[model samples]
Target: MKASRWARAAALLVLVGFTASCGLPRVGPNKREIYSGSVQREGDAFIVSVNDRVTRATAVVPALGFSAAFRNAGIVGSDTIRPGDTLGLTIYENVDDGLLAGQGLNATMLEEVQVDGAGFIFVPYAGRIRAAGNTPEAIRRLITERLADQTPDPQVMVRRVAGDGATVTVTGAVTQQGVFAIERPTRTLSAMLARAGGVAVEPETARVKVIRNGHTGEVWFEELFEDPQADIALRGGDRVLVEADTRSFTALGATGNQTRVRFETQTISAIEAIAQVGGLSPTTGDPTGVFIFRNEPEEIAKQVLGRTDLIGAQRLVYVLDLTEPNGLFLARDFVIRDGDTVYVTEAPFAQWSKALSAVSGTLGLASSLASIADNLNNN
Candidate 1:
C-alpha cells in the first residue's frame, strides 16, 4: 500500500509539471514585443539595462526639450531701444542762463517723439539721434551733450512714453486678451498671464508656448511657476499662447491600473508614476519585469540602444527589476516621458501555482477512484 501510494504521488507531481507547461517563464504575458526585441528601432522594443554607461550617456527620458528655450531666457526683454518706440522728452534749462534761456523761448518744454523706421528720434537742435540699442538715460545724456554747444549748460531729459511701445501679444486661452506694453526691466511670463486675468479654464491641462523670433519654446503652464527657468522673458512681438497639454501615456498588463493617463505635471519619475496608476498588482505582478514602452526621439533612443543602424525602430522598452533593491532607486530617478506605456509582467510563480493546483485536484480525484475500486473488489 505504501509503495502504491508513493507511486501515485509521484505520478501526480509529473502531471502537475506537464499540465503547467503553459505557465513557463516565456509565457504570453512575458513575451510581448518589449521582451523580444534587442534594439529599440526594431518595430518592437527590447530592454536596455540601466547602467552607469547608459545612464550617463543615454539620459533616462522625459526629456522636456526645454533646453533650447531655457537658454533663450537670457536674451528676452532687453532694455535696449528698438524701432516703433515713443519717447517723452523734457528739456529744462535755468531761466537765468541755460540753452533754452538763451534761445529766448520757454525755459521748459515737453515733447513726445516717435521713433522712426530708421530707429532715429529727432530733437529740435540735435537733428536725428539713434535711439535704438540705447537706454533712455543714455539718450538723455546724448541729448544734453548735443545741446551743449547750442546754449550754455543745457539740461535735457529723455524718457520712454508709458503704454506706448514694446508690447507682448497675448492670445489663446486668456480671460483678458489685449496688447499690453512690456514695462521697463522686461516682464516675466507670469506677470503677463496675470495681466490677462489668469487662465480662463482649469490649469490642469494648460501649456504655455512662448514664440520669440524664429525660436519657439513650449512648457506646461504649471511648470512656468514651479521653475523660474520655464517663465522666459516676454519680448516685443513675442507671441504667448496658453493651450491644453495633450500629451498622454497608456498603461497596460499587470499594473494596478490600465488606462490612458495625461501628464499632470511638467515631468514625473517612474516610481511615482507607477503609484499614480495604482502600482503593480501584488497578486499577479512580476516584481522582476516592470517595463515601459515608448516611441522616443531618434537621438534619445540612440543613447540607450547604441546602434547606428536605427532605421525601422523608434519603439523602446525600458525595464526595472523590482526584485533587486537597486531597481527601486533607479525607478525613483527614472523619468517617464509623455506617450510612454507602463506595464508590469505577470508573476513567474502564477503559472506554477496554477499547475500545482491542478495536480492537487488530480491527486484527490485519484485517491477517491482508488477507494471506489477497493470497495468494489471487496464487494
Candidate 2:
C-alpha cells in the first residue's frame, strides 16, 4: 500500500507538470483584444461595441432568401441563325393535279442542305439561298418564292437540323458539361443545366455566372430556381458557368464545438448556429455573453452614429443573453452572415474551478508522497 501511494504520487506530479508546461487555446499567453478597449466608434473605420437590441434590418439577410439585392435583368434575347448550320428542306407539289409535272416526280422531295462558308444553302431548283442570320420561317418563305416559277403552288418547309449557331455552352460544376441547343424565345440557361445533369452540388451553395457579348454577370445558385427573371436568355454565343461556394462561419470560445461550419444554405440563424457547435458548454459558458462579430454596412453605420468614424467603424458586435426567455426567440429570428464569429464568454466560476482543482491535486500528491516516505524511513 505504501509503494502504491508513492507510484500514484509520481504519476500525478508528472501529469500536473505536463499541463503546466503546455499551452491551451484560450488559456494560453495570448491576450484577448476584446478587453483592450480598442473597439471605439470615434474616427475609426472599423469599430466594435455592445448592441443589446436587435433591428429588423440587421437581423435579416435578404439575398440569401427573397434576394432583394439581386436586380432582375428580366427576359433577354434568344438564339439567332449563324454560320455552320444545316437545314432540312421539304418541297411539296400536287402530284395528282398534273399542273407543272415536268419532272414526273413524287409528291414530296426531301433534301438536307448545309450552309456554305459564305452563309448560303443551294437547293436543286431554288438556287443559292441565304440561310444565315434568318430564321427557318424566313428561309422557307424565300425558298417558296423561288420554287413558284418551276411548279404551281409550291410548298416549302425549312428547319434547322444541326447547328452550333443556335446553341450555348454550359461548363463547370455539372455532371455532364457540354453545349446545349436553344430552340425557343425563353432563356435556355435552366434547360441547358438540366440537360447537363444539373449542378454537381445542391443549388443553395452554388453560384452561376453568364458571359455574353463581352459582358458578364453572376447570381446565387438558388436564384435561378426561385426567380424566373434570374434565368437570363441564352444567346448563340453565350457561356454559362456554375461553381460551388464554400461559405462558412467560425464558432469559438465556450460553445460546444470550436470549428468552422460550411454554409450549405444561403443563410443560418443564430439559434441554429449555437446548436450546430453543440450548444454552450453548460459548466463553463457565460449565457449572457454570446456575441456575433460582423462588418456592418456603411449606410447602416451612418444611421447608427450619423457619420463615418475617424477609424471607418464598420465592425459591429451583437450580444444575446440566453438567461432571458425572449432572447431565445430573438436568437431564432436573427440571421448570421458568412464569415461571422460567434463567441460565448467563460462563466464566472470557471476560473475558480480551475484554481481549486489544481490546488487540491497538488496537496493530495504531497500528502501521498509524505506517507510513502514515512513508511520507508520506519522500515
Candidate 3:
C-alpha cells in the first residue's frame, strides 16, 4: 500500500506538470526596445522647453542613445569646480619691488587676486582684465608685454589668484553640489567632476545635463564620466548636472524576466517589465498568472476601456491572462505605470513541487526522530 501511495503521488506530480504546460508558454519575456522614436521626440521637447540641453538629454533620450548625444555635444557629467581653488604666480624682472600688491604691477609687492563671474580680475594698477579663458602661460606672456612697455626691465608675475578658472559647477546627483577646481591645465569635464566628487548613485540611467549660456543639454552620466576621450570636455559657461536615481519597480514570479526593473511612470509596459527581469525562474514560476498590482486600480480599467483617463484606481490591481498566446502582443502594447508591481502566479505543477518538497522534509525529520527513539530504547 505504501508503494502504491508513492506511485500515485508521483503520477499526480507528473499530471500537475502536464496540465501547466497548456496554460501559457514559459519563456523569458521578449527583449523590449524601451526607448523608441516617440520617447526621443518627447525628450527633445523637454530639453528645448527647459532651455537647458542637459535636462532633456538625460531625462528623455533612450538610455543607450543618450550617451551618443552627450559625446557629440561635449557635456561632462561628473566634474565640478568650487570655491577655494588655488592660484599661483611668478614674477620676472619686477621681483625687485617684492611683488605688486593684490595682483598689481607695483614694485616690491605682488598679491593674490580674486576672480569674478565675468572672468575678470581687478589689479591694483591695470584695473579689471578678462582672465577666465586665457591659459596660465598665455596670461604670463600678456603681463610681460604689458610691463615691458611701462617700466625699464618691468618684471610682471602671473598666477591664479585661486585655481577657480579651471573649475566648473556640477549639481544634481554628484557627490557634492559645488565648484570643482581643475588640477591640470587641460581639464576635461570628466576630470572636473572627479575633483568635485563622483556620482552619488548608480550611473546607469542617471541623466547628465549641461547648461551653456542658459541653454540646457542632456546625456547619460556614464558617457560623460567614463568615456573621457569622446564625451566630456568643458567649454566656457558650461555647467554639468547629474540627476538623482529615480524610483522604479520589479516584475517577478510568473513574468518573463524575474529581474528587478527601473522605469519612469507610465513609460514601461506590462510586457517590457517582464522581459527586463531575466524572465521568471522557470522551476518556480507560472506564466499565465501575470498580474500588475498598482495602487491606482481605476487607472488600469480606464486603459482597457480606451478612456482618456490614463490613470485610475482599478488599473492599479489589474491582472493579465497570458494563457492565451496572443496576449503576448497585447502585453507589449500596454504601458506600465510607476509603483506597479507585476506578479506571475505559480502553476499547479509548481505547487505540487512545493508540496512534495515539504512532505519529504517532514518525513525526513520524523524518521530522524524515530531513529533516535529506537537507539534510546536499545540502550
Winner by TM-score: 2
Angstrom error of the Cα, residue 195, model 3: value is 8.0
Q: What does the lDDT read for residue 279 in candidate 2? A: 97
lDDT of 1: 0.72
Question: What Cα-based lDDT does every candidate model obtain?
Answer: 0.72, 0.69, 0.54
lDDT tens per residue, model 3, 34-104: 11212244421100111122112212224332343344654422223222323455545444342343344
lDDT of 1 by residue, 71-155 (tens): 5656444466778877778777655655444456546655658788888988877778989888888898898888877766677
Which residue runs of candidate 1 sit more than 4 Å off their true CA positions?
3-28, 31-44, 60-188, 200-206, 212-215, 220-238, 306-314, 355-379
Query: What is candidate 1's TM-score against the reference?
Result: 0.58
Candidate 3 ranges with C-alpha deviation above 4 Å:
1-88, 94-112, 115-146, 149-151, 155-167, 171-203, 209-219, 222-239, 252-278, 281-284, 295-304, 308-314, 321-323, 327-337, 349-379
Q: Using lDDT, give the best candidate's number.
A: 1
RMSD in Å for candidate 3, one decimal? Answer: 12.4
Off by over 4 Å in 2: 1-33, 38-54, 57-80, 84-118, 121-128, 136-164, 305-313
- The superposed Cα distance between candidate 1 and the true structure at residue 171, in angstroms, equals 4.2
- For model 3, give the 10-residue run with minimal summed lDDT: 43-52
Q: Can you give the lDDT of residue 149 in candidate 3?
A: 58
Q: Against the true structure, candidate 2 has what lDDT?
A: 0.69
Model 1 clashing residue pairs (backbone): 41-313, 42-313
- For all predicted structures, in order, the TM-scores are 0.58, 0.69, 0.47
